[model samples]
Target: MFATTDNGLSGTGKPESVFISWLLWQPRGADLAVEALKEVQKLSRYDDSDPDITRLRSLFVSLAGADGPLH
Candidate 1:
């Protein structure tokens, strides 16, 4: 479960990845968000061709309303 608490307000049980993606992508233009995602991809310890990473790339593409790789 995910949780956030501030000033006695709290939220929990949200998908952390979605929250992370929103924090990364919502405040910026699509190009910049995509660039940030590429940096995340580089920092990941998964295999270069991991399927989960592929899915994450697909999600970021969808978020940007575009098609192609994050790299």
Candidate 2:
């Protein structure tokens, strides 16, 4: 299961301390793609008035494309 830290960053609960451990631990390509797509979709729904959201949406789009099917 995914767990967050007290500071809101992603955490492994011990040893490693990072906010993106889940991505590293995902077992399947399909699962990673689906999770990435969900994040992209959420970012796309952000308010137009938020500049940070625009940057985030662009970043997510880049990452989604990078994670797309290789064959």
Candidate 3:
């Protein structure tokens, strides 16, 4: 059995775990990053009222298109 929470994945433990998963799963190339950004954008379109998600969507947009060292 698993506990449920407001966030997806439920009682998986620390909030940091969700962020860590994102860090580890981040897209490697520009192409994949663009796709990832699109997906997040789609999610935002569904529910723009969530401040946290809106902020994340903004970050994705800001990072999506860029040239030269992304490092």
Best by TM-score: 3
Clashes of each: 0, 0, 0
TM-score, cand. 2: 0.44
Ten residues in sequence with the least summed lDDT for candidate 2? 10-19
Q: What TM-scores do the predictions have?
A: 0.34, 0.44, 0.45
- Off-target runs (Cα >4 Å) in candidate 1 are 1-48, 68-71
Candidate 1 local Cα displacement, residue 46, angstroms: 8.3
lDDT of 1 by residue, 1-71 (tens): 95655333122223346437555655545565566466456535455454445455455555555555444
Which model is ahead, 2 or 3, in terms of lDDT? 3
Task: State the lDDT of candidate 2 residue by residue for 1-71, as single tens digits.
Answer: 96565533222243222215545765665566566567777766657565455545555555567545221
lDDT of 3 by residue, 1-71 (tens): 96656654233444345434655686665475666466565645656665555555555555566343222
Best by lDDT: 3
Candidate 1: global Cα-lDDT? 0.50
Query: Against the true structure, what is every candidate's RMSD?
Result: 8.4, 8.2, 7.0
lDDT of predicted model 3: 0.53
TM-score comparison, 2 vs 3, better candidate: 3
Candidate 2 global CA lDDT score: 0.51
Clashes, model 3: 0
